[model samples]
Target: MSIASAIVLFMVIWFMTFLIVIPFRIDTQGDLGEIVPGTHAGSPQNHHLKKKAWITTGITLVLWVIIGGTIVSGVISVRDIDLFGRMGPEGSMWHSESGSAAE
Candidate 1:
């Protein structure tokens, strides 16, 4: 893949991993029974964002390496996923064998 594509792919993976990691090991003020006067009870007592960010980065890096390797090795390709056989020369990006947009 090109540099731009690789960078974009890494970013997407990182953010997705971050979302998955955010809800884990969370400590809300309500759970801690230490709600501050001005803040909502559900507010995070300690986000540990820096730790989660590092974890997310590590997980995303591993995932990106696997996916990028597959892409480079052609273990998966657009044609392999063209379930309707709509990715050949006779078909446009969105066209299927019926000569219309793929469902």
Candidate 2:
């Protein structure tokens, strides 16, 4: 893939992984029985964002390598997922071999 495409892929994977990782091991104020006077109890007591960020980066790297390698190696291509015969032939990028536009 191109540099921009690879960067975009990594960013997507990183953000997705961060979102999924955020909720894990969370210690809400309500769960700790120490609700602040002005803040909601459901707020995080201690986010530990630094540690979480490190963990997320580690996970993202591994996933990015595996996914990026697959894409770079072309082990799985768009044609594999053309459930409705969209790409028609293997080498065609956008149009099908039968002169039909991808629906």
Candidate 3:
């Protein structure tokens, strides 16, 4: 993969991780208040859940950054030439053995 492609892939992974983990962070009063119906406010279980969510979000963000940075930088060293044999010789579909002229 090229640097640009790797960057795009990293962005996609980062975006997906953000979308999945953002809902878990209880950084606001509204998030804390969205518990089960009739549940007591400021309960131990609620606080624990919020803490766990924040931790998970932090871990995910850290991992995403580390992995994405490594992947993007690694891809930067890749050559621009195509490694696959898709271009054929001289940019023509027919081989020399076929004795076919370029159309």
Candidate 4:
């Protein structure tokens, strides 16, 4: 993938992980029986956002490395996942199978 694509992929992964981790180990007002007079019961008393963000970053980094490496190394390619056969027959200028550009 290009540099821009790699960055985009990382951002997407990070945000996804953040969303999934947000509710974990949370201390909601209702759960802790400390609901403020003006606040809803479901409101968080201690969200630990900073800690969750760091945890998300760590998880996303590991996922990005494995996914990015697969893309860069071409283990699973676009054509391989083409469900409707949109890419047509595979052809490359640099063919590793025959070790020649022109057959």
Best by lDDT: 4
lDDT of 2 by residue, 2-48 (tens): 99999999899999999999988989999999999999989999888
Q: Give the whole-model CA lDDT for all candidates, comma-separated.
A: 0.89, 0.88, 0.57, 0.90
Model 3, residue 15: displacement in angstroms?
0.3
What number of backbone clashes does candidate 3 have, counting pairs of residues 3 or more apart or in separate chains?
A: 0
lDDT measured at residue 46 in model 1 versus the true structure, 0 to 100: 89
Ranking by lDDT: 4, 1, 2, 3
RMSD for each model, in Å, please? 4.6, 3.4, 8.8, 6.3
**lDDT, candidate 4, residue 15?**
100
Candidate number achieving the greatest TM-score relative to the actual structure? 4
| Model 1: per-residue Cα lDDT over 4-78, one tens digit each | 999999999999999999998889999999999999999999899999999999999999999989998988988
Overall local distance difference test of candidate 4: 0.90
Clashing pairs in 2: none
Off by over 4 Å in 1: 89-103
lDDT of 2: 0.88
lDDT of 4 at 100: 62
- Report the Cα lDDT for residue 46, model 4: 94
Per-prediction count of colliding residue pairs?
0, 0, 0, 0
Quote each prediction's TM-score: 0.82, 0.83, 0.32, 0.84
In model 1, residue pairs whose N, Cα or C atoms come closer than 3 Å (at least 3 residues apart or on different chains), thus clashing, are: none
What local lDDT does model 4 show for residue 41?
Answer: 96
Error of 3 at 83 (Å): 24
TM-score of 2: 0.83
